[model samples]
Target: MAPATVRRDPGTVKPRIRPSPAPPARVRCATKRAAVRIAYVFDHRLPSTGADTEQLVHMVAALGEAGADVELVLPRIPGRQVPSPDDLAAYYGVPPSFRVRALPGPFPTVRALEKPGFAAVGALARAVRTADLVYTRNLPTAVAVRLAGGPPVLFETYRPWPDQYPASRWLFRGLLRARGSFRMVLHSHYAMERFLRAGLPADRMLVAHNGWDPRKFEPRLSKHEARTRLGLPMDRPLVVYTGRITPKKGLLGVLDMARRLPHVTFLLVGSEGEGSVEREARSMPNVRVEGWTDLASLPPYLYAADVLLIPPTAAPLSKVGNTVLPIKTFPYMASGRAIFGPRSPDLAEILRHGDNAFLVEPDDWDAATAGLRSLLEDPETAERLGRRARADAEGGTWQARAQRVLDFAAPMIRTA
Candidate 1:
């Protein structure tokens, strides 16, 4: 029997998710219960440079670890180069166990023709048809797979869309309640709530947080060694923040902290390398902003830090369709550095104040400044917090995340 759906509010019914038996405790499992064939579809430029690409590849690799035969299907945009298996493997740092299929698409310059072309290819691909299900983060692929009567769709997302367009929203709403939607995976309960409010069924939703790959951080380097390797100062105390250097992520607030704490170095890794703010960052005497660092090279930067910051401001985020949970959180936890971040329901799912990290209210520069000062003043407490963060991080590995996803999709795979 399917899970029961209840009407919480008339004319604005919100959805709820039924939790699985997968424990909240340490998730170090690779049961390999049964082999499930999955064709993961995400149409984007090959050799992606964004964090989203990392998430997709890791999901496929983890699924493979859970005894699933997985193939990553993407569009072969005309005139654009497609990355070889080895290229992707080296860049993403994952075992090249699955095949990459580049289906035909329209000319790369033609934006409108691309989605239709990608969808048409998905509708006819043998990899998609033979698999137990078509799992996709791409909206076009999800829409295509269902309309063309392909396998079940596990449409996973962090938020709902088509809010402005009535017709598109209507179609997506139907797709959510459609017979072919096997599961709708969300990254957090905050995201789950967004979809629920968008009218998804209780049983149809699953919340699994994004995870980190432990291999990247293992054989951990010491702060002395890391700083030396990166040519950073040996004498200064560091407060580091990794990921996009945009105002939406509360960089402005972070910059203010640099002004207040002239003695402590505030480092911003992964800056876009140009723009007005970055120019201003270079002007600051206390702030040291570095250009975008690759994933493989990021651990050293993180390990060199005394504290990690994720200061997301009023960016139309937090328990919404936007990026509430930063991708760097897992790695920051794995690094065992004391984390200082905004206190929101979405972020609170992983980061806890006075527990794993030191939390402050979102968009509050004064609270953030005071929080960092407190952590710096008391070294013992900061070390204690870092230890707890590392201990808890053990359960949120890439493989562990894969096991949880497999556990949730077990029923559908078994029948397939």
Candidate 2:
């Protein structure tokens, strides 16, 4: 240092070199990456029975998987039986990301009956205010959310008649005329057409078919293995039907078929306790009825079956049977089992005769019986139809369905 100082002038002294500062550490804008928060409002309480609960759970899970934050909002009443979060997650197979928010309201029973009352409305409004979108299949809750005026509302209709209240119809028509901010999602082509005829704007309508999770419903065990595990007869040709044991489900026709074909075992997997349908089924030597089977236990039963029965009531034109497509159809198709059912427009949309399913005339026991017999006797045809049905189901998972709905609502969601 002393030698350098002597040799160089102070003004011309050299300085040590240093590396340029690293580019500002890359930062991701969290707002841009945040998931769209959705408030899923429902009029009914959870831990309930029926296909609606299953559909709602799976749809919520799918929406979460599709990058949307879903929170289930329902009325909360003191001293009511509500499922614990852990129980709900286990039942629905939902991830930790999915959540449930119960809005404080009057008693659960009263709130359920009068869902859009003042207290319920206040609760729903508060819940929806924090969300990017409000989704509901319950008409009253949908209307309430729409009126609350926070997030964009999406109303999904599975049945046409149930939501066609005179007041609701008038409100919907007015909303369409005013180009209201809400949208309607119909479950089937028939439902879309019905809503269109009912004065909903075509521009705001989306048709989303019911779907299943093949990973849940698909056959994981051999037929013999499943039958053995379930203690079902391994030798008999088993025809299975899984749903409420109601007459409107064409259980009468199934009973008739069971009587006609004594060799075939008719396994009816759901009954409302020991109700009339169970009594009728029990009277038949070939028919066996079991109480409700949980979702996890259903796959083995479906896999054990040779054919899946989907018999709608005699009145294919009835509101209960005709206007709505069965939610069970997708699961049946996903089970890789031949489906035999009446040829309604709802079924026709997804099923092809002699291809994925055997479509027969509605309420025609003779035709249904023949179809079941054909599936039982012809292994090649049954296998062919089942494989084709499974292939078709591959395209209709709950994930695909949720994505479709999200895509349809993308513009609205972004603006919201």
Candidate 3:
């Protein structure tokens, strides 16, 4: 019967609901770690053979191990099926952390087809756009990414482009002058200087030597045991070279040495598809060409050798002549075997003559023969040099090299 009337001060304008200042825009502390997504563009097919393939495998694995989300952007043959990541990992002897993506294009083996198809370029550009950082060894691929206006790129140079591919000199110069966030990684100081002369900024250049997986290269068995496993004669001194059997690699000199020193057994552990170098070497009685040893099995051959030879020719005009720091050098050092090679500026940086290795004058076959003779005759000297080399290699593993690269790229990644 009675309606209760509540009387309030009309002046109490009920705290005008101000939306609690939107909770300070949620000072959201990011719970998950920011993963650095790296797009490594390479101009090669997966599960390929050669030093470049080996380097890519190690670099990708190392980057992954360094906590980066790494993916390899590679070329795919027009009609062929792409290999799975596991297949690639198995082929390269690397961990499954290294992932691969294929962009449809002409196979790298066909040098006539220099540039990738338009579709491939678009795909690569998209990948580069999404990545936090881009790393590439192929200048053409980097050029495509630059043209696409993608993220900052790091170009890793292993050779003097001007010398090897005179045709690409103009492209390389353009790359140096292009307006963008770009950096250069040279495999040797010589490479750095070459690029600097070609107009790259000094501050943007980094010299990172090629690296090896120490675990794979470490001497795992005794010399006799390794020789026995590899089916080598117990009496002869074994001299070995492991690399592509190209004329530019000074394989002819190795053959000559084999002919001169008939007593020593020369083992060439590498593929020999280029021209007649393999066939010629096979003709020699003292030279044994064991083609394409798997990465896992290479250590035993290195362990079996009394001395390792890196005999690239001194021809300044050859592809590998003036500006190559051989990838095998690091593994050779880690094998704890005496290394003998020409006095390449690149090699000299890591190897001191008579200290960690024996370096003779380039193309001086006489000096090379003499040095090999000395190493063969003096076990004490060889052992000392080998020990020094192994000590040097202890710090230069692929994982360590990857960490160095990541540290170098951190600033660029953050800014990107």
TM-score to native of every candidate shown: 0.86, 0.86, 0.85
lDDT of 1 by residue, 284-361 (tens): 777877766557677888889888888746463633335757778899999998888878777889888999999887
RMSD of each: 11.7, 19.2, 20.3
Q: Compute the lDDT for candidate 1.
A: 0.73
Clashing pairs in 2: none
Identify the candidate with maximal lDDT: 1
Model 3, range 32-59, lDDT digits (tens) per residue? 4456788888776666666788888889
Off by over 4 Å in 1: 1-34, 160-173, 176-181, 316-321, 414-416
TM-score ranking from best to worst? 2, 1, 3
Q: What is the overall TM-score of model 3 with all chains considered together? A: 0.85
What overall lDDT goes with each candidate model? 0.73, 0.72, 0.72
